[model samples]
Target: MSRQELPGLPTEATMLRDFPWVVVRMRCHFCRRGGDARLAVLAAKHGPYVTMGRLVVEFMKECAWAPWNPTRRPQKYGMKCGGYCMDLRRPDPPDLPPGMQGLQLIEGGLSEKLPAAPAEFERRKRVGSDD
Candidate 1:
């Protein structure tokens, strides 16, 4: 029954049945990031080969939009729940701000800086667009 906690997360981890990990979803804190995640406390450091996956196919028929639930669906349809991120339950609430990428507050940060905006492209800027 040993339990551990991450700084902003709100769950106590528990050992899983077969994997070398623990499960913790104590009070369901939503990630500001887009998807849902489960806490898997690892005893040993695993490589990038180790990953957390979300199941989305089952909800394609039920979702109002994809949120993009069904990863199998074609993107042209633009179903919000029909994409890569779906199963975000457990310790996180379904409501939260979008997740952060790299060291950025949203989307791309300094790590992925683009080349200077072309003169032609800059002329097309929208009235309220901040790019």
Candidate 2:
């Protein structure tokens, strides 16, 4: 079915399903700028739409609060599983340090970035260094 068939759903759902990756719009509460978030699903490995839950959890966890749901019971307790509503996963951007907006514009770098692991040398150097 055409995306227009679903009037209530967010505009990104169709694109999300089609692409291995997509730049999602997320609100930045501090700068009032929109952060271009990225999402990907590996259909060959995980099956189409299968990673939606895991991605949802990761999204919520990054936002530092559980997903807020109004329809489920216990209305007082905030947050619930995002379920199939991957579009619903959004955490209001908290106040961030200078230049700390989610994804950043750079002079000599790529527009897209992902969480990275430290270099082996750096990782070894940082061992219990904070202690």
Candidate 3:
């Protein structure tokens, strides 16, 4: 099936199917393109990635498409790569299942089963933040 056919979200996470494996392709929020990989999925992957937190950190760590050097961000050296150089891009958070209730997901249609953000006021904000 095409990337669009798969549910949940791309590289960030996907709900485990009855099958053994899943191919993931998460888009870069910056460059807007991403590489694909095969991962062993088990369950829902939670996120506050849009606000850039642990979920974003783990996603970047796991994503094969991310740059290796954390301190020095990528620069296009005229197609030349060196000294931990690689592409620079951030992984967007994957969609959550109905039970967890995602923060910024699009609702209706295919996502009809998905619920709105949590009713508890605290749940609406990032897990740990002064904001």
Candidate 4:
């Protein structure tokens, strides 16, 4: 399904600490490999701030069908891993009020513009040494 259809699904920026479940249950249909990971243990190993998307990638690394698995046989038309989290299929939560939706408010708000890069540094092409 397209990402737009899965509006309730967590985005790449969704941190591990923000996940709804205490334990993450992941299964790979291709390898028949599955496991339950405690949120606390995962947070300790990967940090609470690590994104769910990143964890998904890490979790699928060992699967033979995983596209990014370097040790897997090089096949031009191999099936991709069907690894996924079980908790992700939970019913979507009720929508928040309009005012409560969107980006979280920062303490000081964001800067109007980014700081300009140094022109001298941009022009330099030397591999080493200040000169």
Candidate 5:
């Protein structure tokens, strides 16, 4: 299914219990921080149902690069912490068939059509008339 077909943020759908690996690996390239935690221990501490995204947030609270950290220093250009779960990164969109080409409509679609004005317009015109 496409990303849009999913019911919630992709991360929310993945819980701590979804990982099959005994060790859950997390890394942040910006800060050069990496670690591996026992899956069972993580689940026990954060609860099995906590999302990988939420867990990452809790783990990166002390990182200077974390955008959500209130005490983080301001930078020339704001950069979010590149923290990620090794097991749960989103997969690339599937390639189209060899003979098929992708197409996107930029304009002139039904979504651009506006509804007709209500009868109230006639009443307002009568009220404003000089005659």
Candidate 6:
């Protein structure tokens, strides 16, 4: 079946809340192309009322994993070629939109589900801010 045909293939947290193993694809909000443009999904746990939380999706890329060079944002370098690289945050807090209500997702789609952001990178974000 095609990616989208997988029901929750390009699964949303909401979809995963119902179905476990699902395959889906997500398009890049920055890229305005079609086809494999959507190469990610947001998988979540299934439930009745509606389980809310961050959805963890899976992604597969054909690039050499690089260790944060402490000076690269990955995206800045063309050498860093790969799949999803951002978290799918909610558009609005409190509650999701009508369509988003049934679909648990925010941004980045499945590609958003990474092992974890580099600690150093996070540290930089709070360089001057108070904890």
How does candidate 4 score on lDDT? 0.75
The per-candidate count of clashes, in order, stands at 20, 1, 0, 0, 0, 13
**Model 5, residue 1: C-alpha shift (Å):** 5.0
Ranking by lDDT: 4, 5, 2, 3, 1, 6
The residue-by-residue lDDT of candidate 1 on 8-118, one tens digit each, is: 232212122222223312211222223323433322433223333312233233555534445456666553543333322233444445563224456778879876865
Better of 2 and 4 by TM-score: 4
Regions more than 4 Å wrong, model 1: 1-33, 39-54, 58-62, 66-80, 85-131
TM-scores for all candidates? 0.18, 0.26, 0.22, 0.57, 0.54, 0.20
Best by lDDT: 4
Report the Cα lDDT for residue 59, model 2. Answer: 45
In candidate 2, which residue pairs get closer than 3 Å at backbone N, Cα or C atoms, i.e. clash?
A: 67-79
| Candidate number with the higher lDDT (1 or 2) | 2
Report the Cα lDDT for candidate 6.
0.35
List runs of model 4 lying over 4 Å from the truth: 1-12, 92-131
Tell me the RMSD of model 5 versus the true structure.
12.7
Q: Pull out the clashing pairs in model 3.
A: none
Worst 10 residues of 3 by lDDT: 79-88
Model 5 lDDT, full chain set: 0.71
Clashes of 2: 1
Q: Residue by residue across 1-131, what tens digits does model 6's lDDT show?
A: 66445443322444334433223233233332212212123322223323222222122222233224445455654453234423233233223357765755466866767766555553345578777
Q: Compute the lDDT for candidate 2.
A: 0.42
Which candidate, 3 or 4, has the higher lDDT? 4
Ranking by TM-score: 4, 5, 2, 3, 6, 1
